[model samples]
Target: MAPKEEATNAKNVATQHSQEEQLLHQLPKPNIQNSKYTKRAVLKTLLNRDDGGFALVGERVVVGGWVKSSKETRVPIFRSFLKLFGVGGGGNGGKDSPLSFGQRVQQQPVFSTVTLQVSDGSCVASLQVIVDSTLAPPGRIMPSGTCILVEGVIQQATTSGKHTIELKAEKVLHLGVVEDHEKYPLSKKRLPLHTLRNWAHFRPRTTTVASMARIRHELTHGTHTFFQNNGFLYVQVPIITTTDSDEFSNKFQVTTLLSNKATEEETSTKASGVSLESIKASLKEKINRIEELKRTDSNREALLAAVQDHKKTNELALELEAEEKREKAKANALIKPDRLNFLDDFFSCQAFLTVSGRLHLESYACALGNVYSFGPRFKASTSQSTRHVSEMWTVEAEMAFAELEEAMNCATDLLKHLCKWVMQHCHEDMKFVLKRVDQNIALRLQSVQSTEFEKISYYKAIDVLKQVKDKNFTTNVEWGVPLTEEHESYLADEVYKKPVIIYDHPKEVKPFYVRQNDDGKTVAAFDVIVPKVGAVIRGSQNEERIKMLNIRIEEQGLSKDQYEWYLDLRRYGTAKHAGFSLNFDLVVLMATGISDIRDVIPFQRSFGKINN
Candidate 1:
């Protein structure tokens, strides 16, 4: 070798060595999983071949998973010789697909061979399990969605690109019996996303649902970690509340009027002094008196009268017992409707499932400095659109003495954090989603991480919309008019081709709690909009001045008493604060490339549909 060439090669070797040393010090390297290392094995670890390969052939491992699809490819008695060539054992089975190993040996109608696709929940991919019918039978049929535990040896790779390592089943350790194959909701054929929504409970067993579920979970954990690591306290806001800080949205009311009559009956029964224990005691005492009368002092006339008295006591006790039974049945049932006044209901005036934890979170923020509430939120909207759901999860945070720009910065950081976390941890799931669901999800996530979100005031957004008169918009773009989803989508997807953050919205368009800017027309508010979904987050600096809050409440036609506590929060403290709420499921939907909001939530409650 030439002298200069040898020196260059040596330098390259040294650079590679330095990189390896730094990586080792950063974290302990993962052990290569191959044959003979079988205490426990995960799907990702087994399928991963890049990091020095995994799932050694001939390793005996116990794998538990829900069956995605199971097929019994019976090789005809005549084609039995084809097994010698390994035709039907673990090939992809599709002869027509471009990537198939070869033309699949046609299965004969005579002999039985079973192959199962199982997901271990370790990642988005499935583990090919080659089941030998003679060794471990799958009953009459191995239905899709059945859970099974199989102790098997990870042997030879399958011809299919879908699975890297195939497990040769030694025994069918446990096979969950599917009561009726015909009635099972999940079948072998691919079901539409909407159809999957109908079977949320069992949908997770499928690859799409399972992958989306893990992605959502990782996003949630990542979000919590970001805040927790950044010196933020995780505070839980109440689910049932009487306060509606944002008066703009309708609340899902909780009233006792339905069970009012039953409740009243119960109350009257208690007031009338009917206790089961008291009744039982009285019955026993009367019987004892009768027994004493018969045994000790039995004058004929007195004995007769005592017997009559006992009969009368029996009737009265029976009637009381019947009344008690009736009351209990009524009270236990859902409340029946009645003309109940607001003050006479269960919670008294009014109560509801919280629309947002922002208002309550603020109280904690004032005391704790920086705090956040991440929990499910409810809405009573009857709309059946893709964006609207009766119930969803949200993360709302409050920063004391913060402004619109600071809130926007935090939001940008959070979005980037979430994107990076998903890319790093949910790589397989993202790849699966990109292949099966939305093709644009990768770009959406990349835009958040690599590109800067365009920041523009509400006025500036209006100006941009007005300039684009060539394209007719469904929603009017006039100043002071509310910008709908259509408007936001256009600005992000069409105009800027990126995420757009719009702040300083019109005062009338914003809630009463949003701080009014000095201009008196716009409020200190901002919304984060992405390409596909218009606005994912909305936040604002609160109306800190007690007098200003009161005035805004009155001007907005809000009840004075409803916000008394919220007003007290401002009245009692300096209360200059800002907060924003991002829908957790929405984030998952955006990140996973899921088009419908319904598919993202595990159990979605939307419009007139809520399946238990």
Candidate 2:
């Protein structure tokens, strides 16, 4: 009764199996190989080769990675011996006859094996590895953050439902055991970004920090490539300089006058009553003695001696007074000092960690036609905002014979190129960032890469802000008032939904180097404001006329002597040039949608925050 029906069912099952086999054959095969740097194979290459790494199922390879998770399993002596000696088994050791070194160790009352999930940080995925407990102690390699390098054969997973490929280790080549798992910061599965900041040295082992590092590398590579391809020479600018590029009085002073020895010496000197007041009192006493000698009809030679002493003492008093005035003048000029004489410092004058490289880049641009400087910059800002950092990397570029418009165009092109470059080259990291950090990061980057940045005058921007009906800006938008970050965010995020360049800012609000417009009230300056992160790029047409430069420098109360070298470029063959600086960290924040600027940098240097 069932012969014909059973035959039909058997035929149907066979057809289904054949179709599944055809689908498997159609899938792409992975081409896996060992790394050139080491004999060990890269986990990324293995995992990304084919789906589940099935293509290299039977290959023997060495791998090195940090342990993500580990579990130990114990089996009965009878089953352990049977599996170890390949007695009536079909698994990895089923074909062995004589007991090997690993097998001999496993022939105990209870044999233990450790299963580990390991990652090398080359990608988000981790590989499964099984190791004999005797080869590598379970207590040593079981905790998270333990690093191990092992030689193993890739096999199909037998227990882990998620991982299709697992490594069966024959030997433990190396072990970087964690001293204590409970005290480790990254032992927990999830930690807040702020918490990770405290452990920056170990944070890179985490997925988020690793992904950020990769993205940062790609962006840096892209930066150099873009500049090199565009005929712009890379110029290394001085990190220490006498001139304040931004004229903002926010530069960190680079001085040796505050050293411990100097401080102790100064403290002792101050405590010894050797100040100007003491000199003045001594001068008065000497003058009074001379007067007494003159009035008492003393000997002519003695009176002459007293008058000579009085003159010498009076001269000392004047010299000390002048020194105090000079010190006060230096402080008023924004060359901040703790009343320490800069003339006695290492440089013999005031010096500072450069806040921007644009001024220096201009000197190179004048000669090289186009030039750029990329390096660390410092600002002595006391701001504790999420956007402010005491130390950061910046990309500043200057173009010769280019005005504000040309500079703006170059900045736009550079931004678009960087966005496109990272999207293409750092696709995996960007995807990880999108998944873990922000969901709309990819879309935001694509929009920036494709859309043309809108250009509007500062007056126009102010008008647009005034007309906005939905949001209340904290800063009161006005004609001469500087645009706050909130104002910039509104323009770029709410009004334009992309980058917006606001140009022709008020002259009072811009730096002295910015060229004044014909209206005499505003300067030919522009800032490229991006969504989420306010202004990322700030550019301006430089003041080239010598007379105007002097006037502007004087108007801003800056020391003209400090910028005379910069002014010489204008005095001697100054062509109309413009330049801008791009905040590299902010660009990262924009691309990754990371809210804090501290997360992007490796070792954050913020207000009251520094670590090795």
Candidate 3:
């Protein structure tokens, strides 16, 4: 072969070699940091409760999770046995070695390992997965929060005096890739809970929010368990009702119905009189529509004159017009209140989303003896405080033949059950929230669980407020007047330093259903005031006396006829019973030490804002 032919063959071989090398570069390139690798690691075995990781040395496993942290660094990789001779390289080329100095240097930053706390929805706590750099190059490191699948060997993470457990990755599969890693929202830096609230849709990815969510689930489960274990029956109450439960807050009107079928009375219309001229005009209109003409009325005046020539038909037309006007007037007269009665409006009388389920619970309690309703309760309160929300969950329980002390015992037991449940089941989450959000969370929970609440009368609370020497009271502490938030907070937070149960409030200050004391000045009522939250719960040994109930109803200025069903409970088979409502969100916030009640609920609906 000629020299030219040989050169051509060499060029073809070189091209093939170049392509192979490019393909080889696509595989995982190892760095000094992540030289050890396991193809896969079993998440369940690794993050299991008893046995942490399942991978014995030199075992292969698959690991799949989201990236938590990623970093790149360079480490010197020594080459050539001749380096033992203490020979050094020059600027570009080595002085005595075969390779150049530039060739010895790694082109990109070296990556060692990536940490991912992965969860497959099986558990609350995520498994910490440390992935070594063998499967990913510097450019290949996925961004924080990027989902990934990997194949690796389970081994001790580092060979040199390192005891940490990690996977030695052989290959990494990008299940979903983030092209740009720098702009990821979450970072190693601590974020404020308020800032996390702004990104509520993605806040659960955060540790604090995730912990709160778990704690919330536990609380819900604990509540259901507590009610179910007790003899109390869970009952469903009407969300939309005609009667207001508590008259203090306004109710949202319910204007829509499920089976919104149109009624014949609404849909029916008067049938047209069979007029020969109208039939002919209708046929012509249909014809005109099909033809799509601009106008065929060149002889409209002549047509009108021809019709007017018949005096009998003209008289009939005038009679029809007068009859139509009379019919229209009759229809309009039938619609007295609304324009045609709003066309099957489904709203004849006023109805609203209920403020409380206690009234319904009372009816159920009268029938079932012991019953409770736990569901979303709505209110139209305009207060813009952190404790106030448009919608809230309430646990309203009623028991027959029970006094206020029994009610208080039930409240204390229920609260203790929740605290114990959190301590046993949600310990991890409780720890996270207590450390990050509020350090006093543990103490608060224990205080509610272990300690007996301070019992004081409403009059006593006022006296205590008057006696305060250190802090000046913002609100007036007068008898027979309603207590403000500032007044209640001082009693619970500063004066008592524990939960204060203030009972026997003024009859006018309390609801109409509260039992009137013998003196007729105070009622058998109680308010559970906590330190952080002013009033978390309220209850009363409801008025069981018919004549006294009537007097109280009159005093509250409520119509007696409207509350006859509630008043009937007093009239027939009256039992000395009491109940209370626990604001579910406030309870969680109080337990977790979160200042804002909004943080405890998933989607908060406030006076002016509704969020997803």
Worst 10 residues of 1 by lDDT: 98-107
TM-score of each: 0.75, 0.80, 0.69
Off by over 4 Å in 2: 1-34, 50-52, 83-108, 159-164, 260-338
Clashing pairs in 1: 34-56, 35-56, 76-108, 258-335, 258-336, 259-335, 259-336
Rank the candidate models, highest lDDT first. 2, 1, 3
lDDT of every model, 2 decimals: 0.80, 0.86, 0.70
Model 1, 1-612: lDDT tens digits are 999999999999899768855654565434534335644466677775563223265567777777777778765554565556554456454665422432343443456667888887777778888887776556633777677778887755555465556888888777777788788888748888899888878888878888888998899899999999988899999999987766777777787675656655654546887675776677788788778878886788887887787687677778777887887777666542354477877777778899989989988988998888899999988877677699989999999988778788888899889989998988888888888887878877987899989999999999999999679898778999978888898999999998999999999998888999999999999999988766889899988899888999889898889888888887676757898998787788779877789988899998789888
The all-Cα superposition gives candidate 2 an RMSD in Å to the true structure of 15.9
Kindly indicate the candidate among 1 and 3 with the higher lDDT: 1
TM-score, cand. 2 vs. native: 0.80
How well does model 1 score by local distance difference test?
Answer: 0.80
Model 3 over residues 1-612: C-alpha lDDT tens digits?
A: 999999999999899768755654564432212223744443534544342332243456566766655555443344333355555443345453435552565564443555554553323445444555566554555466667776766554443322334666667666566666655566545677766666677667666666677778888888889988998899999888777667777777665332232222232223444664684465555555434432455455654544444444455557766666665555444222333333445766557898888888988888788888889999888887888789998888999888888888888788778878888887667776777778888888788788789999988988888887887666667898888888888888887788889999998787788888888799888888888887888888888888888887777787787788887877788888899998888878876888887777777787877657
Q: What is the lDDT of residue 374 in candidate 2?
A: 94
Clashing pairs in 2: none
